[model samples]
Target chain A: MVNTRNMVADNYTPESVAEAVRKYDGVRRKQAIGSLVRSLHIDNIDVVASYGEDAAVIQNGRTALLLAADGIWNKLMEVDPYWAGYCAILVNVHDIAAMGGRPVAMVDVLSASDDAIMTEVSRGMHDAAVAFDVPVVGGHLHPDAPYNVIDVSILGVAELENIIYSSKAQPNDAIIAAIDLKGRIHPSAPMNWDSVTMKTSDVLRSQISVMKDLGERHLLTAGKDISNPGVIGTLGMLIESSGVGAVVDLTAIPRPDLDALGITFEQWVRMYPGMGFIMTANRSDVETVCKKFRKTGMAAQVIGTVTSTKKFTLVKGEQETVLFNFCEEGITNI
Target chain B: MVNTRNMVADNYTPESVAEAVRKYDGVRRKQAIGSLVRSLHIDNIDVVASYGEDAAVIQNGRTALLLAADGIWNKLMEVDPYWAGYCAILVNVHDIAAMGGRPVAMVDVLSASDDAIMTEVSRGMHDAAVAFDVPVVGGHLHPDAPYNVIDVSILGVAELENIIYSSKAQPNDAIIAAIDLKGRIHPSAPMNWDSVTMKTSDVLRSQISVMKDLGERHLLTAGKDISNPGVIGTLGMLIESSGVGAVVDLTAIPRPDLDALGITFEQWVRMYPGMGFIMTANRSDVETVCKKFRKTGMAAQVIGTVTSTKKFTLVKGEQETVLFNFCEEGITNI
Candidate 1:
């Protein structure tokens, strides 16, 4: 393997990375999410929490039912139908996993204009479902639709007390980011890293279970799976939700060889790694939690610290830059 | 109020009704549904039934969790976003209700190209949510989408033993169609018969409860709510699912004043009457079931009889036309 240590040392620039993340489409698309939540929200008996969280929690007697839905962007669908279908299930599963819940089943609503596209999309969905051991139970199909769109919603169950939320991070905690950097960028979709698709099911499941273990043991105060917004942007969202701030050290983030991947340091911070998460843990529990992710074949590093000030800052050696100020300009406005 | 008896006597024409139902857009859109189902289907453990059924059933413990998603057509959304949103929730609730299930909660994925459209859609969704008493728990939003769309999926629960299925109808059964004809066509949406919106909550709840009562009492063998395909087309689907046939006497179908509404006989049969269902039951149980619907402020009529041969026929006096033959041309091919 090419040495990543030197590349990490050479690219420790604060301004470049912040600018790339600020302009990333993955991060920009989320600006309207908060306003949409405000418009659609309604008071009800069963709902515990709706928007501003990974999964909506519904009270179901002794257990809490987690409900969440995600749609693939049209741009992605145009580039790769299979990846679009796979991501539809992948992102929804992560939504449940991020909330400290066990994914039970999923249903999909697919609207495609042609048969060839539908076959490829369903193949991707089926393969992912089998690999994750989660069934695609039932869904609606619009075969003669005018355009191609895939939307998936998942249901999961969790103990009411054991659930971890994005809005619960505490001050003075360590921000830990864990990611599998063994795979290359997907050929069909440049923004996606193809780590889980090539890896054995055993390895993928183990990586997913690490989050559950952390939640069960109460090791993480707040956590989120690294999604379309990439690692730093995801951490920014968690910090925003928790009403706190974070200071991240650019050199400490784990990454693969930048030269071999033919990508810049700024691009890496904005790309969606196939299997990754950003979490906040108490200073005392940080080491043990990082050790668990490392055991699952991921590079785990304590790259930042949670702060009391409502500003997200990026630090590279002596240089520092403000990434987000939650008090002024919000990410999701949640 | 007009004399119902005189109106019914002057407007009944089986040949005209058959032609109208055959050409209705609600009935025409369903022709493509079966081909789509055939393409997307895959083997899974939890999925009990899909496609031609009202709601897809997933096995969950001793009970079954009914899951379904529905999206309003673009034409409807352009004309009335509020009605589009209302129908999105209305259709999902009906899917579960048709299956003898109790709806628990729902999640929506909404995309709007403009603010006025988004506000109207949300207003309609909020009103229907309160009317049905099923909360909109959580969902995703695409605030800057190029096109407008509203897709909703619901979760419901039913006892495995009491869950009604569309494939359980038997030969020699009486076909019972129940509809609330106490309202006029919606001015904004001509195809939509505005029944439940004008009724009191008590009346609306009772109308929905009639299906659950039928399932619990084992009064109906197979059933489905009248959807875009209207009354006759909905019955055609039920017959197809049951692997049987049906024959209806045009004189027996209940309808409002066709002359006053300025709609032809064919249009009335094909129009999507809000809060309508077509069910099959033994001759002995027909009267009792009709009484239950009538008590809920609906008009119930024994319109047809189930047959062993797979053919759907409509007769008015001596004139008859074959609408569908499951052995030859199936509606949904369930």
Candidate 2:
């Protein structure tokens, strides 16, 4: 693997990166999920798992049914309705992919202030649905609503034994970051890394199926898709869900040429990649898992190691800074 | 069956009821769906049926996965956040039930303006989920959105051969309206008929399972839950989807004591019932289907007959008026 440590800008430090991620809106918004979980929780015999996971796993006879929902941020809807709509479907598909399931179909609920906004949002959703090969089956539309919002929910299926869960990571496991790094930062949404949009359906499907292959092979202990919280924050969530912590060498994270792209390492770690995953696997199987992802044209490498301590720490050469202490304050507060 | 034809208020007319329903906001809001459907449509091999159905049927091996979504109206959220949240889950559960599927779990996307609204919405969602016996598996929450909106999606399972579809109504079938007339008008939201809230879980489950039982027995030709568009408007949608039409007798509708409840017949027909369904079945099996619903405490009646006329008409004794001519204008425009 190429060592990106020397290419890091001299101006950056571990403390700055930690502080920036902890204070970021993407990470901060996750705190609300804890209380919402408490309010919405209900017990059912069929649910194998629910809250705090990428997708809830429900036992449907011999199959594990995966269900997940995601809503685009209102800010995204206002700035670019088309991108917002596209991201809504993209995120839900990733939720299932993160769980090592085959996404079957999606349903959407769209509320728009006017017809123009609705049309643009639909166009974006249609394009993404076709690209993902997941049909937008049926949904509700509020045509004359006072505000615009797009929310998509997906259903997926997987074998019960092969399902990957977020809360199953063990201490001493290798933390790997796999990202498709061959695309530019989205112009419409700067915080978005537009990798998947330019890729063909075959490439996208192959990348998504890597997680499933790993699950079937029992290569992953835990996995989660890197989302709006970015790579580090997403890793924070995965460790938090597993009731564990991790220590990362910041420079080991795979990325395109940061110097040529004119983006600092700090900003790059916080941008939501179009296709990315942070996973945990046994040290012995780490090479095989990374190779599978690499075969799909994604850059994969071991970025961190799961730790027994309940504190997430970032290390940059000699400097080390703690980001989140799960024993005190959690990321999603789960 | 009780015939209350003479109990109809003297001031009502086929022309007036038809006009009021044709102009109703609940029906008008659905007109935007046709264009939205055209925009979101995508073909997938696994999808058995989608779009114009109550729940999309996705074939997963031997199981048919039912997927559907609903967003609570902003007006409901503003008037009463609790009801809005409750209805979000309620509508999704109904969507699956209307398709004769056993709802497994649900996920939601909620955007609240403040913590208080979120808490209230959560309470409502929690109560309804418990009442219906379906767990809220997982969801996304926007804690700081400018507007409050609650959208929920459900996953259910059914035998592929036993799945009921809204687009399968045969011409000349009996149109059945099954509703629990034991409910009073909701105080906070006048347009809502509160029925299931006070019922026990056993009663609620029994009411929901009636449709599934009908489907398994192949007793219904087509079915859809009566939602915000009320009875006639919902039937208009079913006929519109099936590419058929219907003629209804106004006095045959099942309703509570309107005079005692201080409401008019026209208003009662437009009120959204807490537990209701509109179905089409063969003329010979209509009595058996109505009896099944009645055993579960709902008032089931043959309110209309499906026709190939491509026009929806309402008749009062000797007078008849066309509410919607599917050949010209359509409700839901689908």
lDDT of 2 by residue, B284-304 (tens): 999999999999999999999
Q: Pick the candidate with the highest TM-score.
A: 2
lDDT of each: 0.83, 0.91
What is the Cα-based lDDT of residue A12 in candidate 2? Answer: 77
> Each model's TM-score?
0.92, 0.97
Interface RMSD of each: 2.3, 0.7
In the range A1-334, model 1's lDDT, one tens digit per residue, is: 5565666435747988888899988888788777666766668887777676788888767677788888887778888998888888888888888888887777788877888888788878877776677676667666667778888888877877778788888889999999999898989878888778888878877888788778889999988889888999999999998999999999898988777788887878887898898889999998899999899899998999999999999998899999998898888986
Stretches > 4 Å off in candidate 1: A1-12, B1-25, B31-39
What's the interface RMS deviation of candidate 2? 0.7
Candidate 2 error regions (>4 Å): A1-10, B1-10
Candidate 2 TM-score over all chains jointly: 0.97
Give the number of the best model, judged by DockQ: 2
